[model samples]
Target: TICGLFGFELDNFERAEVQKATRRLLEHEKRFLERGLRNFLIYKDMFLKSVYRAGLPEILIYLPIIESGCSPRARSRAGAVGLWQLMPSTAYDYHLRIDYWVDERKDPVKSTEAALKYLKRLFGYYGNWELALAAYNAGPANINRAIAMGKTRDYWILRKRGVLSRETSWYIPRFYAIVRIAENPAEFDLNIENAGKKFTFQVLELEKSLSIRELCRRAGIPYSEIRFLNPELRRAITPPGRRYNLKIPAGSLAPFLSAYHGIKKEYIEDVAVYTVRSGDTIGEIAERFGTSPSLIKLINGLRGSLIYAGQELVIPVKEGGLINKVPIRNNFRNYSSLISSSIRYTIRRGDTLWDIAKRYRIEMEVLLALNGIGYNEVLMPGNEILIPVNPLLSP
Candidate 1:
């Protein structure tokens, strides 16, 4: 394989390991891998330009392929986010905004720039691409400690010494494997399609915060399209009281500006702040506000359905009896039969019925009906409850 003959030579053990990892990735996630490659191709120009401008090698473009499969919204279990998989602290260090209204780590262009800057620093510290790549996965301190203990800066040596975490140990090889296969898809018998047009957008500076749905309406585009263009925006509304750069479809800026100015001032204030009280859950608050729990979490930066007392959340409310315009699919109606074939969920510490309902993406009313529990029922740890099995809901 080209990977074994490339910039970093692989020993027999390493070659076999790389081949095994490549095979596993190809066999188990071929479609997803192909989609990732397609996504990479879509942003190839952006990646190349960003890397070249940073004075980094073009191969660095493949980093996001391994980090996030080219998905801007990718988030890891450890709270690392975006295509570059930057943790919150690293993102903050890079000056990427992470707040209630937006998480800039999920912005494709901004995060790519931030990641390139960070990678350059890592490379300068290590003086070797392999070591720098390893440090990118594990912290620099960990890599430095490993180099000190192993008395060598070679990443392979550290891997052999078992000085890196299992994930970090495989990171370099996996990256190499992805690069090799991507560089020579035919050699690996893989078929990757073009991702059509390159992603292009124009930034419109907004004087006041506007509901994303309203922006979409004025732009004559679907809400989903605007959301796709601006993945960094976490809420239905943009943050208030500041000039925010809003990305819209190319050439639609003039139309958007004209339509935006025509909107009524009252409709712009569509969001309401609600302070969470004791026994409050995201689902209950969402229900009260005529919004969805998922939207609340997105707006407030809540990772899961968990909400604590005294936490203030931004909730989108209906305007003039018009339904909340965020176009989330109406899946609540499907919950009645969905819960008929259910599974047991053990109540954990601080568990609430609303938490369980939100986690499973079911209506709280349906959850109450399933377990014959009341709306205000108090839940205790270790109590087993019936939870609906919905494939559409994320576990």
Candidate 2:
């Protein structure tokens, strides 16, 4: 009867197993499970509507309960992320942008749409709801292999044969239990509250890069509220070189637009650039700049932590109007004397005085003074410059 009501029928044995699991879940993890269920209730209307629009079953909304505990920021040990727990590769395959700046996986609307498309494709491949669900948990390749090895396409048969992981084995039953409980929470002594107001927002396309803090300050929006809406942004600031779709509270778009225009360009600071040194790493650079590795990766558009010597990276400094402060090693007298022993050096692509000084073990001040260059002077490739190399050091 429960299966028929849900538009999917399970045998009596399967029903008994599902009920047993549901009872166990309710007994031990009720409070913990209720928190996730409550979160789902907040967005239930949005989720169900989206799923129905995608021509998927409304019950699909319950998938996130098990996948992410209804948390948008959920990330798995296997690198799955967001409400639907999408793996990076899977997200990318589905055209969900997973850059350092905006991981669309964290966006509920975007991730849910992507998840639906993925689910539809899995259903098409398996041609069975249960098999599709299994494929979704363990991947189609794993399920295909299991089907081949077990000589059966039945999800339960494959599970019984131990061809599927224990987690995959229970995934469907857990999903079913959640669906049943959600259909009638009152039966389980659960009290679900209506999401007071539907989560609503307006997207403001940013013309230029700005920090979230500055955006909130200018628009008079709460920092926590703005951040909560755009959890995908890895850094405090929106990334440069593209129009970022910034989500703002509903009814605040007009104020935000007016204030954003009034804000001076200088008030929106540029990210500091740091050229990598021989012994530099993303972690070390982050430490030096008082930022995070994720922020560095985001600003620099790096997918990984591999950085080579002389690579320029954008440093994610939270504070504005801050200069890059490289430590001056030598005294003024020693620095002045050190400039006397100079060698003619040609600037390469992306070369800076900071990098040159670090490379030659000379003070940056001495390098600037020796070359008659200003601190803000742009260095061009093939430009000849004098480097004050130490007598004991080789260039």
Candidate 3:
């Protein structure tokens, strides 16, 4: 209400722009409106108790409409993300860590707290609720300058001055229209559950830094569900440090904590170099390395798989070398001199001997020859294999 009232102080143009934006939202985002309302209802108690305290439910409902339309894993073009749409810098200011392993902006509960803090601060800065809402939509700095230049605190006056962009000017009205529809979903053609459901969680305290894979193993929980619970963990692994709270399904906490330490941590290696050539694709390279294109993309910081001829790309590999490098063997006495060394590796899941050989830039026959593996021998996990360390191959 305060945020909306602030809109009254805007210039005629600003007010009209807000109205136009409101019309656009009412027309374009009908489904999103329903979803936002549903989520608010679902998280009603938690939203009210943890964040809003005494704020109007409509204000709480307005968040997802402005954020990600209630998409839990929504990522913006600017990289501001999650249900609350927090930017990285702002997430950090609110103590939401973004690191190799985790990004708390994607964590709904954590991000809600951060978003509320930001909203509250904005409200405090602009006493007029409409101005606060406008500031939230555009930014306080922009609104402040607009008010100063117009010599009027009216949002419509500022809008007439053309200080805010079309989208931002209308953002508040859109928010208001959405609130109107959200308050009474049945009035529209939309027919679905408006009442929110309850979500329960059990706090998981880590005794040691463990990968999500291992956590799932010990807990008898699926990785999909684990990801749902701990979206903050970016990679499958949780980084080492002080124990942080991990939310899990309501019932599994006790059993999970009991065997959490017993599951052996299997760390993946992610370092490799691949030569560019005539026909190389990110998907192909990823398949060859037994990883996903997204992982490769992330590790290499690739914009869009645009590569040039003869370019060298760094690839991720299993952490430890599977095959041990062979030591130097004696040179031939008859000829001038030739020496070689080789490495050994154990077969791992999803690994082919050919793939392994190509990874180290060695011929398939050479790999088979060095390891004394039979042509018919099936590669089994943990089977010892040898790898030649010499870059050159004998003719």
Best model number under lDDT: 1
lDDT minimum window of 10 residues, candidate 1: 327-336
State the lDDT at 331 in candidate 1. Answer: 16
Residue range 1-395, candidate 2, lDDT tens digits: 34222435646225766887798779987975787788787667778779878877766888899888888887664446788988655665676665434667888888999999999898888877788888889988888988999999888788789888888888888888877887778889975664564557899888777666766888788888887778677667786555788888889999889877876432223345567899898998877766678666655556798989976666655443243464322112223344346567777888878878888886564564344333455766766666666678856
Work out the TM-score per prediction.
0.68, 0.67, 0.61
Model 3 segments beyond 4 Å from truth?
1-23, 53-58, 194-197, 265-395
Question: Where is the poorest 10-residue window by lDDT in model 2?
Answer: 327-336
Residue 56 displacement (Å), model 2: 1.0
lDDT, model 3: 0.60
Across residues 1-395, which tens digit of lDDT does each residue of candidate 1 receive?
A: 43223234445324766788788779987887887888888677888889888888777898899888888887664446788988655765676766445678888899999999999999888887889888898889888888988889988788899888899888888887788779888877777777475668898887765567766787687787778778888667776545788888888888888877875432233555566899988888878766677666655556788777866465656544224544322112223354446777778898877678888887664565444343444667766666667776758
Tens digits of per-residue lDDT for model 3 on 302-381? 65977665655545554334212212121111111111354446678999876786787765544543332322347667
Off by over 4 Å in 2: 1-7, 10-14, 194-197, 265-313, 316-395
